[model samples]
Target: MEEKKVRIHLEKHYWPDEIRARRKRNLGRILALVGLVLTFVFGWVVGSTFATGEPVEETTDFAKLEAIYQIMSEDWYFGKDVLELQTKLIDDAINGMVDGGGDIHTSYLTSEEAKQFNDSLNMGFVGIGVQYYDSNGTYIIERVFRGSPAERAGVLPGDIIFKVNGAEVTGIGSDELAAKVKGENGSIVEIDFLREGVTVSKKITRAPINNTAYGEMIDAETALLEIYTFGDTTGNEVMDILDDFETKGAKRLILDLRDNGGGYLSTLETIGSFFVEKGGILIQQEFINGTTDTSKSSGFVTVDWEKIVILVNGNTASASEVLVAALDENLGEKVTVVGTLTYGKGTVQTQRPFSDQSILKYTIAQWLTPSGKKIDGIGITPDVVVELPAIMENGFEPLEEGETIAPDSVHVAIVSLQEALSFLGYDVDRQDGYYSPKSVEEFKKYQATYGTTVDGVLTQEWISRLHADVARVWHEE
Candidate 1:
């Protein structure tokens, strides 16, 4: 296969730099105190006041901590290299301090983790573009980006990733698998995946991925815009789509934010301005210091719509929820939210980078909708609730090539198979895991339509076809 060249785009958001500068300035006094403590604890000097002439209160907590460190470093029999042990001890102490706060969002990231986190928000990485979900320990591809190496290499949605670069991926976390798959641009990654009970390996070249939003005309009058994330260039991508929609005379808009985890807050504000009028409040933030801040639209209404539909699912969260709330509140009944409840992530986090390039991402405030409704644990309920089929949510179970669920068979897997058939418009009598005569009839009908053998028994080939057809229809819709 011929490899296609990919262009990489980099656009920095201003807020990250601003936050870093502000954090550095504010941490000056704290760092000075830390320096004084270190100097006193190491027996460099004993002083009652700080170097800047501020009276410092004496505390024994620092001495106790030093004593523990000394015992661990000098007396512990299993201790390894002194320098390596010291680094590990410091990293653990920082992690323990952050984890002790009882907030899940507040985290301490090592230098490598910090880089990956920032790269994710900026969409700045080279990889075989794909999004996956963790099923127990197995990773299943949920989406394959258009024109990406994965898609070009015959990777498809619903495929089970078995290995990456000859390493078995079972029992591995999603992040670890992703780290294994991603590499330098033009590098080849060997991916082994399970498709229709068959494991196939493909060597795909890594490429820079820039896609965040995709738009298409659903009909002459309706446009469908799906945003995967709100990265740095999301605002610009949204504007270009709106421009095309205007040119095509699309009046009804379907903004699909399903599974969008969200990115920079500045991108949210910029995109929000495209719909909400200037000075209209989009969100309200309540800081830990008992202060509140309001974020308003920037008066950049690029286009107006006759009607709008915002599609959200359980994965829609954070900045995505903010946009849904803003549009629904400001646009009145013209905007409709469909799909299941969104992910409740109302807290705001800010990252401060250390001199060693590690980062501390701490929750600074909790955000509220424009209506002052707090959705921390409570997600935003959709106007029209639409739940996906169980089979789609919890993937299909793997089967051997000749395995067949005969007519009158009753098994738990039959329930999902029935659901999959029903979702594909098959008239299965019931979804109760019983392969009744009617269920067999529906299965035969599906097989005949797809040019498969018209056997009543549900074979692995039929199951794979059914899953692929359902996935295709779901993507189209």
Candidate 2:
């Protein structure tokens, strides 16, 4: 008898540069061939129709679209140059058609937008990689990715971001601020941060960042794995972490998918294989034509865990929800889902690229769980619902420096302060945005314990201290 050899395949992520280069080269040849064929066919059709003198039947609703285009080209007074106007009209037509489909996810993207979309999924954006949260009007750095430009530039968590590129970020949305910070890979961004009552400035060079999954041992037998997105590298990242957990004698698992919006379907299948047995249904898709397709596990079980806990929140959507549903249903009683309800985005979309390098990403199917439960618009309910404090969920109003909310003062900030104080084990009479005498007493107690001035006045410094303490306790928990 001959000995048999088995080969195990691991998914590897390709760098954006190589992937884009290869795509452009192949697409260039394809577009050239397609253009020649389309030109010849269109010329022949027009010539034959004109020669026949027979009316072209309007079989489809859009059959007269070319006539409408001709009318606009010939008669529209405000039309720009022929080529530019044609391009604009074609893009507008595509958008109108897609928008009429009534699905928000099914839309078109320009060439540049398509590139950014792909980069987001591949985790290959060029920027100072830092995640921030809006504290009232102030943006605070919540997380600085390790080995990133921001981390190298001494950007620390809890630092208040004041300005980007000399423009104040006080009134801008987080997305707008991020756009101002991100640029070409070699470009430099000037960031002003308020740290410990001092304004700190840093000039950081942006670079490509690739990060998704992270893991660490939480206790003797428990391991915590946090997956930010189901990107191309996520499978290998999860595998390495699970292997490390096994080596450290950890059996219980806590998979955190809190704000993960999700990414590629292929990555989802790869990660799903670890928890689900081979041939088990991971997800089912029902297409427009009423055909159904099933995705099964690849049978690459990495760890034999005693128990698994999945943490989710409202922002946990799409592929993240798929994983939670698959594990909860397939693993039966062994898996537990905790935290708030997930984001309901259960539709599957596929993209088609145009000759212009633009893309049309349209919904093709609606996904169902293993037990055939439709998750579209109806999110997966967790076994344990652990809602965050109201103030934490909805951010608090910021108090300016030297501004204090004294005793008997009624303000919305008082409500937030009371909530934070209550969460930190301080005794408070009311959390209704009223600074009553009882609230003042509790505030003084907190100040005394934290070694701040024992005055019964709320300052921005005190709020900052309270915020830090709240964050520390939550992190430890």
- Per-model clash counts, in order, read 0, 0
Give lDDT tens digits, candidate 1, residues 138-165: 5667798767888899888877788888
User: lDDT per residue, candidate 2, 182-296, as tens digits?
Assistant: 8998899999987644688999999988878889998999999998878778889899988899899999999998878778788888899999999988989898899999999
Per-candidate alpha-carbon RMSD to the true structure: 10.6, 9.9
| Model 1 CA deviation exceeding 4 Å by range | 1-60, 76-88, 152-154, 163-176, 187-192, 198-203, 391-477
Question: Worst lDDT window (10 residues) for model 1?
Answer: 6-15
TM-score of each: 0.73, 0.71
User: What is the C-alpha local distance difference test score of each model?
Assistant: 0.74, 0.75
Model 1 TM: 0.73
Candidate 1 local Cα displacement, residue 367, angstroms = 0.4
Q: Model 1, residue 10: what's the lDDT?
A: 14
- Candidate 1 clashing pairs? none
Superposition error at 329 for model 1 (Å): 0.7
